[model samples]
Target: RVDGEILKGWPTPTGKLEFWSRTLHDWGWPELAIPKYIKSHIHPENLESDQIPLITTFRVPVQIHTRSANSKWLDEIAHTNPLWIHPIDADRVGISKTGDLVRVETELGYFVLKSWITEGIRPGVAACSHHMGRWKPEGHKGQRLGISTVALNQEGSEWSLTPRKGGEPFASSDPDTMRIWWTDLGVHQNLTHAVHPDPISGQHCWHQAVRICPAKEGDRAGDVSVDTGKSQAAYEKWLAMTRSADRYSPDGTRRPYWMLRPVRPERDAYHLPLKTESAEV
Candidate 1:
């Protein structure tokens, strides 16, 4: 506090909090400068009649990022990530009961997971808890607690993750390794998720609008199918929404002075002209 008074300031272009962002306006985003209801790509009104919003941002209380997936104590409480669908919506998708297999389809491809019918989530929305699916490629160094070793097959723009061996009882130097029993490690849905980046905030849009349907004949648990071609298209679509740095950096600087930098570079290094020339080699 300055002189024991309350001090209030924010990290905006303005010294104080900004009601309208001048930086956004000057970057050719005048429409987004003011705070108002901007419709998301998957907004309810914008969604097609058959589509349901898939909320991918929810996290289980016990886990923190992907690291805690290897924690035996945490995995015991919450291990599997079932697709949470309301009973009404579950019926529409032919999911009769909890634990039934369901395929959630995105623009790129699909992932099969168990169904969880409940009134806990909204009727028209489906949610899969974040950070449950953690896998390691076969022959790669991996943790034993909560990760499964898998074989990754790639053909052109398509990728698939198949389980090689799940966590099982085995003789090891550590006695606790034999005590491990649970094997229902969740599937990695993030692999199939197409990136939808926010133009202004520069954040990947996590919420998706997906088609919920019954699992196909060959679909298995923990299976992820992705066509990288569609993923690349989604990335380019969002990238085009953003103003080009080459065009906007009239002052020769890459970004605004107030923007946070982890390690501040030399002043001359911030100039794009000099930086571009050095990269030519």
Candidate 2:
């Protein structure tokens, strides 16, 4: 029994044993080192007091940082941004299935999204999957126009507008060209998270405070109005700094000489710049 050893208690101060293992370190990895004796234990007391109104958690597999919606395959799986809420809490807020978009507000900012009432989440807590609804680029496979002509069309399924379709030339009538007009494509949940600090750890809790409400008809998905005056001011200040002559290089270059690094040449790579007319002939 290795008693009072610091390595024994990892991530927790008491170093309590967590799981059963034959070796002190499993799989020949130092990070996996654990005491064999510790069995299952509950550490609910280690968490912050339940009375604390604000808490922070994260989304599940359905969402990934602003990119999942770009994939037609992924979007087809999880179509909408559904806020998972406890049935009790859902009732309190008058939210229900088929509910219109709900406003999720945090100290950082607020935005409207659809609600999905489920018993899966704890009653004073709400959850959302991070993986759905991705921002569509000017032209991509899952955008409104991209879906109509390419993805939905049975004839030209081969002409997808994604990285996979990179080398393939687009058909002339491809509706992907209309995607340029599609704006305000999808919701970005990060904007709803505020920058709040955790008192115990002095760490910023980005998801600390959030509230949900049903969105009225005509309300756009990503519309959130929070005061970003400070951010605008900072941008203006940065613009002013960049405009100053002293910030520029002596030779009128934007970047300073020391900051630039020389590019190393690749010795073993093949290089064919272009075919000569004689060679083509």
Candidate 3:
């Protein structure tokens, strides 16, 4: 079949690398069928006048996700997560300089973290490491190498996590515990972050739309506040953005069989129950 033919064409309905995805079109996302520019949730137009995007994709090179705390040496290399803000954004937000605390408010709540003024980050958006900000409650047993002992309190829908202690050397039976030297384990940022799901991909959206300002009067560094009620509402709002497969599945299946999924059901199980109408006179 060589009329300038494919030895083994790409995996798709067309048997080729696809610029236009029929699956996306058939699966309730016609808008995303073609490879074209689509505005993201954090597109400038989607942000409010006072809001800027909070990028949490950065992680310290020496650190591993969640496992960094296991290594005292790695924790010593990088434990603290300061909000990396551009110098201009800092000044605009009333931050005097680096080491200043800034309150980053999302729809659910805010977290107070030290501001790091540098050109290393792009202007108009702030960044923080997703790997840091590990914390534990005062009496709770957690890793000693990289965590803050915070007092977590809740009232109604409001929740607050305030650090009682940062990383520091402490007398313990283990010599490694005595060797602790750093004092900034970072702030617990997830407490203030709400669930954001991509409507189509269904992946957790981590880029946050946030308002940055100088920390409030009572705010301490590493302080986090969240309204759980607002958190729930954010979930529902994003959930509505999606199109239900039950209604949109042209083949009456939960998903197209060609699409690879980790766990899947039989063809019959992919179908929705048939709807019935009551008899009328």
Count of steric clashes across candidates, in order: 0, 10, 0
Per-residue lDDT tens digits of candidate 2, residues 114-166?
Answer: 67777766777676555433434334555342222212111221111111111
Candidate 3 has an lDDT of 0.85
Cα TM-score per model: 0.88, 0.44, 0.91
- CA RMSD per model (angstroms): 3.5, 18.4, 2.4
- lDDT per residue, candidate 3, 1-281, as tens digits? 46876476665777778988989998888888988887777899998888999987777688887876778778888888899988889888899989988899999999988889999988999988877878888899866777788998999999989989888887677688788777887887777777989888888998889999998899998998999999999999999998998789888777677766788667788777887898898
Off by over 4 Å in 1: 1-8, 274-281
Clashing pairs in 3: none
Stretches of candidate 2 off by over 4 Å are 1-57, 66-70, 136-186, 197-204, 216-218, 229-281
Overall local distance difference test of candidate 1: 0.83
For all candidates in order, the CA lDDT equals 0.83, 0.44, 0.85
User: Which stretches in model 3 have alpha-carbon errors above 4 Å?
Assistant: 1-9, 171-174, 265-267, 276-281
Pairs with backbone N, CA or C atoms under 3 Å apart (clashes), candidate 1:
none
lDDT of 1 by residue, 1-281 (tens): 57998776687756677889888777667888888998998898979888988999887788887878757678778877899999999998799999998999988989988898999998999999877778888888857677888889999999888877766766677776688787878888887788988887688899888999988898877889899999999899889898866787647677777788789887877777654344564
